[model samples]
Target: MMWPLSICVLSFTFLMILALSLVSMGFYFVMNDLVYFIEWEVLSLNSGNIVMTFLFDWMSLIFMGFVLFISSLVIFYSDEYMAGDLNINRFIILVLMFVLSMMFLIISPNLISILLGWDGLGLVSYLLVIYYQNVKSFNAGMLTALSNRIGDVALLMAIAWMLNFGSWNYIFYLDCASHSFEMTMIGALVVLAAMTKSAQIPFSSWLPAAMAAPTPVSALVHSSTLVTAGVYLLIRFNALLVGSYHGSILLLFAGLTMFMAGLGANFEFDLKKIIALSTLSQLGLMMSILAMGFPKLAFFHLLTHALFKALLFMCAGAIIHNMKDSQDIRFMGGLVKHMPLTSLCFNLSNLALCGAPFLAGFYSKDLILEIVSLSYMNYFSFMLYFVSTGLTVCYSLRLVYYAMSGEFNTFSLHPLNDEGWIMLRGMLPLAFMAVMGGCMLSWVLFPTPDMICLPLYLKTLALSVSILGGWLGYELSQGRLSFNLWVLRNQFLTSFFGSMWFLPFLSTYGVSFGPLNLGGSVMKSFDHGWSELVGAQGLYNFFMLNSKITQSWQNSELKTYLISFILWIIIIMCLVVF
Candidate 1:
């Protein structure tokens, strides 16, 4: 049985690889015949000159590899994890569509192609999120769809602006900075769209809501695919990001998001929600790095985050599976004795997330911090980085302490043991990658002076801070520390910290003063003005009331025949006159 399934999966993988190879070959051929290709085109008056032809560039190739590799892992994991489920076939179909859409998105040559792929990916995600067909799953799917749609609209607007300004080509748009207003507005919209999709800052509520999906879906979307779409968009538009004030805004929003999500993660009790918040923080860090003009650092962090975060989420899924759908960390403790291998993998991934030295996350995250420190010494960015890092350590250790180190409060109702061999096989490779991926630093893109050199003092200081954060988190989790000196631990502060959805509302409405009053002054004003035109019940009601009198005067059948005779006479009269 397993053999047939394996063969089918492998065959599909092979075809995808072949298709990608053919696309690459086409790109090369087109590049070699660039002069002929340009000469053989119909020039449109509304279209800008194609400055740079599309091809499979170094950056796109790297991301494509990441997408394919992680997607394959996800499929492999799902084969074992989702076995025996009735909807497995549907799952496989959606998975294939998901991969295909991402491929299209990556290889898209123009704005039109990208938009097509973007909508396809969005549709696929909506389907996957609602796969379970339960109320929570439906709600999650709706939220994801709404948020992605908002971003899609912004992207469409940006494209429209480019086309209107005769900068529709990717390369032409890159050179559009001279039109500052158009560029700035489009950039702002792009950032907003990216934030909503990436689950950054105030747009982050939907991601945690998305935990209603299956664990594998959560792992795939949050760790490698949907959440990273925003980062990918930023990378594609890096040329426009250079020297733009919107870059500063990106840094600000990213920093705020990291800090706020870190704080929320500290207070979250659900295991999956904790991981979700950690993902949000990691994305914020990537956005901040991108804002500082360090796309390479952002990309590197993205890779590292994908490995460890996926490992962590999978481990969490295994634990939940063993525990029979219980996701609350408060109920889990000391399974390390029975599930040693799973515990080890989980712990290692958490350490990497905490930025432990020599781990995948340590190298990538440290580089991001180094860049922030050297390039953005302003108080806001610096404080944000510091607070966010401290809180990252807090949540990383919190996960480990809660799941692996605490006293066993609940007995093992069923034998607490590792999952099946197939599950472990899917996870072990990711764990290995988490520990060893940093060694492939040369393959990763980074700024010139290629090797980042930190002073001994700074390295020591960073290490010390991480250690302190871990200890602080452990103590706080144990309730061993006094809350007297900590202002943020107060009830009001905690409540405010938990209510981050309000930030978007505040940002959208609070600044507008009177207009922000949804049902008060604004409603009254609208009612007063509209009532004068068509009465309080509105134009529809007015028309309905008047229709009775108008209908009574008509002789139904006679009126119809009379109207038909008059129309025929008018038509014949017109024809005769002509």
Candidate 2:
């Protein structure tokens, strides 16, 4: 078990050893978006040149660093979370492969090579999601794989479309693509691809369902690597998308995703699902901010959010692991008495998630709100940001109350003690990062983004939402009153939230049910019926009858043979005389 963890440890060690060198390159490259294309061309195309290209800058370095850091933590955590499992080595391998794909994605400037990373993420994620060998895991894997397939197809389409530019490298054409319709198609396709990957609105069902995977994977995929890939892709291509219809569309869907997930989390009871929905909401926030023409700010939020969210999941994983694999917060209570350190990590991460002042999330979360505040946007968009921000606090506080503050609900005390020590060990690094990551990275990224002044009330809207959400969450969690609008009591609202506003239903069955049934009909009416009637069976019947007639034509009697021979001789003599 320790040996398995060593792989990630070594990778983390090696990267940290090189972090200073990369940091220097990033600083130099900050003044320059560095593009290094190797001469290794995978395919020769007349329209698009497919070559291996790498882009290194502050964004790539910081993002890659954060990705690797989170992955290391996750792999380390999995050693404990997945202990006693027979296939622990296989799990570690898949996790490493996932990291490799993410790095490939991070470094590639070429769409063709990026597909290598993109498809790999989808395939490996499917395998990981189904790692438990259960029906639920299998279904979840299908949803995850098929949903991601949309993005994969979109990337392939974009790669084909890039042939129009005569280069598979999209970095060179970001500005040129802004005004051109042909290039705008690429922008539109790329946005679609991003939406599927980021789990925005219609494509969002898969994110929560993907919790069927092991907890470490949930931390990695939902928090940093898989879901953020879309945001990262859009950030890379933001220049081409901004000030265009595609950008507006992204803003619209992103706002919906943020608002929907926030509302959904407030109603969700399953501990892991709540965090998963929170991830979706945060993704929506990042995308919406990016749509507001602040890619750097969005990137900033993304990095900071990754720091806390991974820790948050790690804490959630520990609790679940300790509580005999139960994930329902309703059944959980006063875990602090049993696991004080775990509780501290959980509470602190939740606080950071709520953008509590001076916490890691505070730095980027506040910046995002303020930036959105000053932007000249419609009232709906503005409300979406503030409201979603509030809902985040609502759920975080609710989680703290139900899962951390109540009386212990277990039938038997299982100690649940220092066995979690290993899990806590994995969380320590991220815990520190989640506390100070925002402040640390903010200085590196930028001091502040320039924005216009606003009325005092407008400026404090986010704070107001946070306080209100906290108050409501306390009441609901304490059972003093029912926040019947969304959580626990209302049939309609809970149904809506439970079903994720029916988008999951629509995206899953709505997309596949029709095609699948139609295929089934074809199998019944055509493949098994019509094709059998006119093709295989009909041809066989025709050939069988012809063979039967030839057999009947054969006469074995001597008289018949003699008559046939005399008739043949007479016919030959008649022909010769003629």
Candidate 3:
């Protein structure tokens, strides 16, 4: 009998093998500078070839490899996390489909083919988000799907616009026609798609709402698949935005998104949402760097962020599982005493998230911050960058303080040991990668070290902000800081900051409120009111009333018939005499 656990094991092994093979191929491609384009002509139309194209370069190959690697581990982790689930097999299948969609997205240079993968991602993610079969999950899934639908539509428009160029293969036009008017439209459309899919600014409400998914799915999503799709798309189409105003717009939104997520994370108590916000923050960083015309740095950070974010989610999953499905951090305290190994991994990933010295995040984040300083930028953008970085550290330490430092806040005899070896096995690999992945990627991606010359104060600024943020985080979490008291007093201000500036309500309610009210009014006035009075029912009533009157005349007494006969005879006689 093939149990679901066995199926998961088999899938994990197969994916691991493929991941290694692809990663090695990617390295070889990078070392030898090779790119292979495989195209199949699926159809032929007037003046166009509907060809399915696959691009295999170092970027695509390595991204595909990392995605598969993380997905395999997540699936393996789910075997333990979802052990008692009756539909674990279905869950595994959904995950595999998601991976396939991501692969299609990564390899396609053609707009049509990219749409296939893009829609696939949006569809599968909706399925996964609604997997729990609850109202909250359903709403979250709808928001996720509809939000990505905007991007899907934008991509379709892009594909249609590319028709003017006589080719759907964007790679061909990206270099030669980058500055043309058509390219500008395409670039703007593409950026809109990326922004929605990546959850920048107004579109950010869906990322946290999607925590209605199971924890393992959250790990996969935040790590490598759904959210990163947009960033990867931008990385591929970066040439289109070069020297364009679109990049500047993207930079502003991404910076605000980064700052918003970090600030909201400090106020978040749900474990998964805090991590989700962190993912959003990192995505903003990636987009901001990419907008500044550093796609390679963005890619570098993307890879490194994937490693630790997955591990962080897995640790949260384990903690939530052991806590009997509780995710509120207030209920978690002194967990380090009970689950030491899990605590170690959690804190390590947290510090990595903070860009602590020599960790996986340090290499990419430090480079990015220094480069931002070195770049020609205004004061506002600069402050946004550094302040967002500090807020990241602040929230991270606050989470640490609340969840791991205080006295036990829950039941006395709860089982909290790190006994789930399978979950631990899944996390251990990511832990190792989270420690060393940055340095390795730094060497591989940048063979020649970037010459970053900065003044001493600027060099030390990142460290200073990080230190101050951590201190503030710890102090505020303890509820002893003056800032905390001020925050408590200002309910409205606190609510605004805590709610992502009420983005979820605006996205969900504000957007829907008007349309919903209009719908209700239409229903009341038309369907049930005027429509009922003048439509089929009204016609039927009119005919019925006339029919009843005619029936009464037909059934009139004999005297009425006699009177009618006498009047007719009198009129005929008078006409004859005349």
Q: What TM-score does candidate 2 get on C-alpha atoms? A: 0.91
Q: Which clashing pairs does model 1 show?
A: none
Q: Is candidate 1 or 2 superior in lDDT? A: 2
Estimate, for each residue in 110-211, the C-alpha lDDT of model 2 and write its tens digit: 897788888889999999999989999999999999998989989899998889898888988988667887788898999999999899988999999999
Compare the candidates by lDDT and give the number of the best one. 3
lDDT of 2: 0.84
Q: Which model, 1 or 3, shows the larger lDDT?
A: 3
lDDT of 3 at 315: 98
Decoy 1 TM-score against native:
0.81
Segments in model 2 whose C-alpha atoms lie over 4 Å from true places: 1-12, 15-28, 31-50, 447-452, 480-490, 555-578
Tens-digit lDDT string for candidate 3 (97-192):
999999999999988888888999999999999999999999999999998999999999999899999878899998999999999999999999
lDDT scores of the candidates, listed in order = 0.75, 0.84, 0.93
Mark the 10 consecutive residues where model 2 has the least summed lDDT.
480-489
Candidate 3 lDDT (Cα, 0 to 1): 0.93
C-alpha lDDT of residue 137 in model 3: 96
Model 3 RMSD in angstroms: 4.9
